[model samples]
Target: MEHDESLRFEVLGPLRATLGQSELDLGFPQQRALLALLLVRAGRPVPAGEIVAALWPEGAPASAMNIVRRYVGSLRRLLEPGLPPRAPGRRLSRGADGYRLETAEDEVDLLRFRGLTRRAKREAATGRPEPALRHFVEALDQWRGPVAAGIPSPARDHAVFAEIERELVRTTVMAADAALLCGTPEHVLPHLGRAARLDPLNESLHARNVLALAACGRQAEALAAYESVRRLLVRELGVAPGAELTAAHTRVLRQEVRSAPRKRDLARPAQLPPEPKQFTGRQAELDSLRTAADSSAVLLTGMPGIGKTTLAVRWAHEAAERYPDGQLHMNLRGFDPLNAPLTAEAALRFLLPVLGVPGHRLPSGPDALAGLYRTLLSGRRMLLLLDDAFDTEQVRALLPASPGCLTLITSRRGLSGLVAAGARPLPLDLPSTADALAVLARHIGRERPAADPAAAQEIVAHCGRLPLALAVVAARAASHPGLPLAAVAAELRRSQGSLDALGDVRTAFAASYRHLPDDAARLLRLLSVGCGPDLTADAAAALADLSVRAARRLLDELADAHLVDESAPGRYTAHALLRVFAAELDRRP
Candidate 1:
């Protein structure tokens, strides 16, 4: 937001970056901290000695520099995937001193905060208190927690982080003083209170917290704040409230600060689910979704149980802040076993009321309700997550007319019609071996998987690296932590032709399988008869006892539902789990 660029680094919150509305995963803990350290000291080259020291405070091992080099290489590729082998990429560069991360003006959130603070100071110098306070509020708003929030301990307490925390405290106290000048001290209360808590013994901050709260007409809260700080100071430092704090107490007693009327706060619907728990991997798809944010809508399609909903919901959470008006989520139930897909009007009925529209106020027809929804979101910046949608028409009905809003839709079928329009198509595929192992490790600790890599590979293979399947199987293993991963892999291998161990996986496949046209379903079942890695259209036709042209059509239909992958032109293959599923069905009547 500060640089007006699509991609920027954030240091004030989590150790991460945002590319447009999408947040990039900055790799593991240490790599994230490294990025944070670079951002904190951006544009200044640090010697390798400083890098190693900051990363490992106690001591640097022999492999520390090599590991740092490896992390640097991985980060370069992550930030600029297309860079050539020997290229240093756009952000990080190596000089004689060591490595440095550079940024344009206001490209980092910390830099943006500093810039805002500087602007507020200038405004105050020019005697524009209101504008000064506005800048101060924005500057304070930039903080989510202490700098580089997700960095692990020890490194998190490094002097670099301490320096940033001091900057936060200074700004918070200054903003509080500016708040008094504008008579809207409430705007600065939260920041002041947080700063005071971070530095309880800093009487200046506590005094400002008290004065700000008192100025906002909350004397009781203000007195409580003073008392809390006083006790903390006494306990921690064996010192009572100092002069500034005592003066704050005296002013509160005399009611010297004039109170301002509070502004009414509007509640916006934050309807996206709680951040998609244990969301494992989809970095490329996430990057695609970020690019697709330029479009008003993006369709996420994959076979059932491939985690289309999880990926969409995860991306929605990352981008939710961009849509300040609100975010709306609805499961269209396109493939629900127990219920029919909600019609356009029915879905609108569920949504419009959530946006503060009365039920009785909803229009009678689909077109009318859609019109009202579009009108309500006419100029608003909002996010609509249309999950499990049946088709393009169902999605188009609920889409906002405003360009400022973004819609993310997930479905089993490709929904090519929307893709034919401007919407980007993001097909969520199974994870790679490493990512699949990571998913299992997230549920069951890394030790089990790390100990038996081959067994872990076998388990992922049997599960076809499908996220839902891996999650279910790994969750069972996690429930019994002492269980051997080889035992789990052996069980999965023994149950090869059935999803008995994964009833949920079977259920997900059945939901998509049941929706197929008769010919396509039969072809899928006959897919079990093939022994090669994949089959040509003519070969598949021979197996299914259909004409080559007819087989091609059915294959296309099955591909659209993601039941089969057309691995090559005129060739196709089912995922391992799907093949076994088809084999089981073929054995049936």
Candidate 2:
């Protein structure tokens, strides 16, 4: 009955509340995150543990529950001023489980978004395209950015938020479909573009974009759109366009006619693995890869389990557009525990067929195969990801001659020989604290880490920012959502650099060790008990009781193999996880 709106809330982007025309400050980050969580639940009672967990992602304080109580009271006072201390709130209510924000569907932007989306779908299903398109656009307008954008990064990245984002993508995709059906393709272009950017590899979304462009009479743009996603799928996912996307391409080319001569595409293999899900961190390295996208080859070298292959694949997918001919991948299996390093001959044998060479018609021997391989790629622009190469010689036979091609290689070894021949060496080191947390967030779950930030930091610090270690910790924590990160950190601390807590990262280190020369292997074990953190070449001589020359030579060998890092001019350091691994080997005798 009131002309002035009494209350309104927004959770489509940053959490917000408004009384009449004025916006209310949501107080600090914790308070804002709290409100956002409740709004996401949408009037359903959130449990106390869930609230406490989400509010203090790093870990709740000793007085965390009390702080939550106080924050709620303050929020209530802010929402309904001039109320008595013990009075119940009309909008914010406490229930048996925890708390909930009571608001009508019209009073919250997200609720309105959901309502409009349902109505839109219903409208379209019932033969009402015009109104359906309107509902879709109206629903999409609710989002300003990522949901709960201004809150804690973990909360902003929570699974619930990710689901909301997925819903947005679905809606955007549907909106584009609706626009074309109703003959208003131009109207949905902006939303379609936004959704496409959010999920560049989504074939369905890109398919709709292509069709919509064609529907609007921009055939050239539509064809380019098709090629873009086609290349994206080929290079990033290692698969050609699925039926839906290919059908869309077919529709665009024919322009509502029965048929046209199908365009011929050269047989190009899309051999890349699926893009890694929730790949976190490594921005600096990703940027470096971007800058070096024009280069013929880039090497990602680091200790075992440092995520070199993951980074290579992640970048390959991102850089796929540049190489429309195709993408090819080979796991050299350089450090596989159960198998020998894939021979260059075997690698060539595997790769030739993937490049469209017939297996029976393939030439025998590495030289002939390598030659044919180079000739096949000579004129084409392509992307090659040679994963887990053992040595320089192992990959040299596999390098292509085309300047138009880019090769990405991942190995634990530095592959100095390849570097001398012009491979841009990108040594993937430990992730930054922020990126480490992001990695944890990506693997485990964002909400838990956000709840106990200190515990999250402890886990990162204890894991030494190694993506592999973080992933292990994340896997454990993720399996048990209610397990406090502090408990995880405490468990890692108790392991005392033992592999018992870090999962199969120890197994990964063992592969590199198994392939090490005897002298270098012994030196690695002795140094774990030697003055740790690092050792000079001369100091290594006294510790191992070998000549300084022998220790120095073995040290360099170890350094080249990446069992130990060359921390300075002549000094070397072992990673904590590696140190533990070495100690385990030392104790075994």
List lDDT for all candidates, in order. Answer: 0.83, 0.83
Collision count for each candidate, in order: 0, 13
Clashes of 1: 0
Q: How far is candidate 1 from the true structure (C-alpha RMSD, Å)?
A: 26.5
State the weakest 10-residue window (summed lDDT) of model 2: 257-266
Q: Candidate 1: what lDDT?
A: 0.83
- lDDT (C-alpha) at residue 49 in model 1: 84
Model 1, residue 445: distance off in Å is 1.5
Residue lDDT tens for model 2, 196-265: 8878988889988887787677889989988988888888889999998898888777665111111132
lDDT (Cα, tens digit) per residue for candidate 1, span 1-589: 3643366888887777976667888888888878888888888887888888988989889999999998898888777758898698878888899999878656788888888999988865544455677898898888998789898776788898888898999988877766665456778877887887787688888888888887777999989988988888788888888788998899888776653222222236789987877787788889898889988888888887888888888999999989998899999999998788889889989987787665654545686466456645655788989999887888878877578889999999898888887788888878888899898888888888889999999999888899989989988998888889999999998887788999888888888888888888999998888659998889888888889999888999999999998888888888888988898899997
Candidate 2 residue runs with Cα over 4 Å from true position: 1-266
